[model samples]
Target: MPKLIVVAGLLLALTACGKESTPTPPPASQTTQAGSGPVDVNVPVEMRPVLSVDPPAQTPAPAAPDVLTGKDGSTYRVGPSIGDFGRFENVGVEQVDGRWVLNIELPDDTAAIFATWTAENVGKQLAIVVDGELVSAPEIASAITGGALQIAGSFTQKEIRELERAITGK
Candidate 1:
């Protein structure tokens, strides 16, 4: 009797596993509403990586302002690009007393040349350029005779680091 009972239970479980159900469709009115766009069907579909349909076009960025163009159409650039003007011996960011500044060091001969150049071009603006960008253009009030020059831009530590890298080419 117990064996017959177990066989009956097994037959019921096998019949339950064979049962199948059809998905119910939405009502016709909800699917075909007037003046509405096509219904957005939420179905699982295979995803794919997007690819460019057209050929890619590369565009160059605008050049930065480097040369100081004078009213007479004359242009001036620093270092070997121009005249025998002095090279920047050392460029770094340092804290003097309690303030941070970008320091530039020039040799004695170059310092003399810069002093003379500034003194001759007093009242004119000299553009301090970096990586073709005109960072600053201050009027030459007097000659910068001292070989050491400090640039204070009120920049933070990060900005100072970037500026140092830009100026030093490091």
Candidate 2:
């Protein structure tokens, strides 16, 4: 009797597996109402909802000071360039806006540097020197232009005069 009962259970399970799965459609009431004329079923499908992402706000970067080196190889701090100039080139110095500017031209695209004034370049300060002493290590604000640029900072009358003379070899 136990064997017969097991066989019956197996048969029932087999029969259930043989049956095909049929999806249940939504109720007729859920569908759109039938129209009197030939209803165009070719209506355009609605567009899917797009994800809206808000970009972070833009903030101005801090300005980087100019770097100067003195005759003794001592570094000094200076200010940013006041006017627009071209790319930097060669080792030379010039005066702009009454300040001494060192022109250290880098062989790279410096457009991004000119775009902002920030303090990010503080650590990688350029070494500016006059004669042989180090003047300052001002962070490069942008690339040099025409192999010349101006340095800005609080300078005493003697310091300015000395720097001008050292830079110009006058």
Compare the candidates by TM-score and give the number of the best one. Answer: 1
Worst 10 residues of 1 by lDDT: 1-10
lDDT of 2 by residue, 83-137 (tens): 2222233333334334333333322333233223222331133333333233333
Q: Score every model by TM-score.
A: 0.45, 0.27
Q: What number of clashing residue pairs does each candidate have, in the order they appear?
A: 0, 37
What local lDDT score does residue 37 receive in model 2, on the 0 to 100 scale? 25
lDDT of 1 by residue, 1-170 (tens): 00000011011100110111221221112121122111121221111111111122253323323333322233334222212322455555555444345555665766676667655654444544444443334444345566655444345657656655544445
- What clash pairs does model 1 have? none
